[model samples]
Target: MIPPPSARPFLDQAGWAGAEILPLAGDASFRRYFRVVEGDRRAILMDAPPPHEDPRPFISVGEWLCESGFAAPAILARDLTQGLVLLEDFGDARVREHLDAAPAEEMAIYTRAVDLLVDLHEQPAQSGLAPYDRAVYQREAALLTEWFAPAAGLAVDASGYTTAWDKVLPIAEQDVAPVVTVLRDYHAENIMLLPDHARSHGLGLLDFQDALAGHPAYDLVSLLQDARRDVSPAVEQAMLAHYQTRAKASPDFEAAYAVLGAQRNAKIIGIFTRLWKRDGKPRYLDFLPRMWGLLERDLAHPALAPVADWFAENVPASARGQLDAGQSAQ
Candidate 1:
């Protein structure tokens, strides 16, 4: 349900005569996107549905990312009143498409992606233009309680989750690592495989409106433990090694990694939950077990020792089973 003030431009603009616009399939979020072609040129038309969709943050973050050398979609033009944007087309080949065609070549792609992550993490904390503070993280986590927990049909552990949050915040605050403006949704689906450029040498980035200043491990987890797609353990470990080697630390880096992974997964659980109940997108619910498995793997580490105890006391044992049942019923 969108008004046409935003899209009327293509028909009106001098540069875009004969422009044909096609509605593109959208993700779980409220935003709607279209592919526009005028002559040989191609671009995207964005519509952030009103009241439910706010363009301010998305616009601000998009500008910041475009300036920062990350491969986010560029804003060619905007109609703020109608919440629309004309964006550069990054081509349609998502990394998932590439990986699917040649699944065995994931190693080379992993290496390249790991290199991209290292470059992002190496940016200094002062370089970050956004911050992922407690309010942001907590809001994201609440999505789980509100969305997934109900779907799980387990008693929402309001107090227990609060207690777990209390247990982990100190460890997170002690994160001495410098922050970078993280593409909070950085992952394979958002990355494109472009050719003919020295950089990427040809990778494109998309769907990064929620950029934040956060730990180095956040984006890495986002890539390696994606909910929409699965990354093999071998590839995950190889990428981790690439990261460890790139960062060359003074103290134990593994400890930092474990805590960050747990935190990232915890945040994602809530997001997926929210995607289901609030957004009416249930595909993400299937990824809950993968995220849970990540949590369990992370908890095996000694750095998550206290958090493990907290998790054991809370979060149900039949967690995966319940989610599966929910999925089938849905």
Candidate 2:
């Protein structure tokens, strides 16, 4: 779609002369972005669905991050009435796309990436971002039953799964860690590797409009338990240890890792299923089996034993067969 006439009002209010629009990616939700070239300068044009997406938080987060000396898009102007935002264009080369050819070398690069996550979370968030409380946790965890239960074609023992989830859910709430700004989608796909820098860290940030005050472990899980590609056992282990040590997690590290991994991977399974069935993108279905494997491994850890045995008993045998079919075709 062309740059809507509605955006012109914002440009006029800010005294920007022209707008040139080009197609940009549509990764999730109903949000779409355009690369707008006006005069010799460039900026990103955001098209968000109202009521579904209010630009209030996005604008607030951008301002806060900019002041804190983090890398974020510059919000040149905004049209709150039309849900349009003019932002500085980052670039097209995402870290994941670049790593496809040689993933082994990503170890050093990814370590640097984790440091940035540390930076974002180190501060006690003052931005009025909502804490990811019990309600949100339960709602996200329920996606596994909604998406995976039907795909696996299992009606085995509903009570078993429910009871097990009841056991695991409370543990996630045990540590009421102080809230910090979390980049909810801090992974290779959303990050862009700045290869030209004299002292390159990792990817320059992008798509951080939905920042929230949440647990530190949440972003760590998003990075390590990635849904796109297989982060090797050696690499994943190294990262787990690195983060745990740096965070000064002493005796509880092992148990925490297991519980966190299991919880996150379970969420991914449901998310992939929803992406396939409801969102019309079966491509995400390919990631299901790998996430299943990770969950099973975590289940072996004593921290997750209550839920693991229940899953083994309840999740159908047919699940592996169907999920493997999707991956094989891919």
Candidate 3:
């Protein structure tokens, strides 16, 4: 990948005049990542660029994660105005990468990840963080109708879905679980496993800038019901049990997990569809089957009765899966 010229000055200003700048895997966001290597030292250069993206939230959240004793990349240098940041490279040992190499270790890795979440939930509130309340959840869930439904060549009115969620969400909130930082994308792809640190801190967090003070179950669901990869039913159940036992959570926690899981899956279905239709990324569509299955399972929870009924009434089973090839929703 070609390094954009706009990033050169920051490389020089940050004292890496002749480093080997190699492109790193980017996510759904507009931000691009590049690894800067000079001899034995290495760092990540985040090119968030222009008006579409901002790195301040990332920097702030990174600091918060680090301060709270979790593993977030250290911001070594930055130019907020230019949306450029140099971060400490935690190396390539991601949990997904490790699991791919040794599937036998999946249980251990996921258990550690779940344990990390339990600890992360205990953190004190951050200043200026927004609440991931019902309105926000409803708005996010609308992505299904706004992008996915049309992309699938079906006319779906998302208002009913949102309306149903309006009724179902209160059951989740009434449980009295303390709201904590919800790292909106806490799935395997964004998590790294650093062997050098202790088990809890070993899990390196990424893509958490969009975090809000929300239900603790949101992130947990994000991990267990990941859209990109198929986490086995056995593994998902074990991790859930592990978390509940460690957290000493009340019986209502499982209900909240199902509710949040349903909301998150609904939001992802729309997001994956939008990514394909608008961004021209079709691979996201491949995960639709797995995501749909997860969504269906989440909907089975009695807590999701209203939203589940909305889906049943609006999105017919025949219209759910992979759509026509190479057709833009627009």
Candidate 4:
């Protein structure tokens, strides 16, 4: 694949002018990725065009992770004006695809991931990062009412949704746990299994530009309750126990997990719907049922009573079921 014209000068400056550029991937946002290869040398070219995307947060967080001894990709070179960055390549062994091929190794692999989080939570969070405060939580939860509800042909109680979130969000922000860096998109798809590294230090983190100072439970919920792939409930439970024991988390951790799970799932449902309706990406609709299933499970937790009641009253079981892609986005 051809690199964007603007990337040429950046590549020339980074001394990778003649590298072969191959299309890598495009995510939920407007940013695109490309793999750059020059003989034995390799790097990832991130095309985070301005106006819609920024790479500075990604650069800062990644550098912090590297300094802290975590496996976030290293920033090799950057040209912020042209929105091009050369990043250390973590290879193709993403945890989601790896698990799909080697189901038997799922437990061991996930154990390492959980252990990484335990280690991460031990460190004090980076300063100047935004807190995952109540306003953010409420705004996120309202995505269900804003995009998904309308797409699903349900006229939701938007104000009631906000009220329900107001009642429960504080539980997630309680002082029972120390605030740590929450990698807001931590999930199987975004974690790489580095074969060259030792098992304990092998997990490579990606797509963490939106990291925030938040409760430790938030990232765990994101990992175990993934939207793109099915993480068995048995594995999820075992990992939760493992993390709790490993981190010596408070008794309130589970409650925070449920609250954040519901909030994140709600945001994802709205985002996926928006991707379909506004961004012309229908493939995301395929994950709506899985998202609803997880959201419903989270709502079953006693900690989510207020939000659960809101869902029960405003969004029926019928609206939350499997959606036909062609019909749903209409």
Q: Which segments of candidate 4 are over 4 A away from where they belong?
A: 327-330
lDDT of 3: 0.85
Give me the runs in candidate 2 sitting further than 4 Å from their true place: 1-18, 102-104, 156-159, 176-178, 195-202, 321-330
After TM-score superposition, what is the CA distance of residue 44 in candidate 3 from its true location, in Å?
Answer: 0.4
* 322: Cα error in model 3, Å: 1.7
Instruction: Give candidate 3's TM-score.
Output: 0.96
**What lDDT tens digits, residue by residue, belong to model 1 across residues 1-330?**
342555866445626656878888787777888888877899888888677777767777776655655566777877666677788888888889889999998988777787777766676543445677776666665665666666777666666665666666555556666667677777888888867433544677777776777777777778887767889988888888887788663254566667767777877787777666666676776788788888788888887776677667656677742255355333
**Cα RMSDs of all predictions?**
2.9, 3.6, 1.4, 1.5
How do these models rank on TM-score, best leading? 4, 3, 1, 2
Model 3, span 1-330: residue lDDT tens: 567786788889889988989999888879999999999999999988879899999999989888878889999899888888999998888777778889998888898889999998877656779999887988888888888777766776666767788888886788777878988889888888887768455788888889898878888899999888789999999999998888787789898999889888888888888888888888888888888899999999988888888888888887777766568544
By lDDT, the candidates rank as 4, 3, 1, 2
How far is 182's C-alpha from truth in model 2 (Å)?
Answer: 2.7
Better of 2 and 4 by lDDT: 4
lDDT of 4 by residue, 264-319 (tens): 99999998988888887888888999999999999999989998998889888889
Let me know the TM-score candidate 1 reaches against the reference structure.
0.87
C-alpha TM-score for every candidate: 0.87, 0.86, 0.96, 0.97
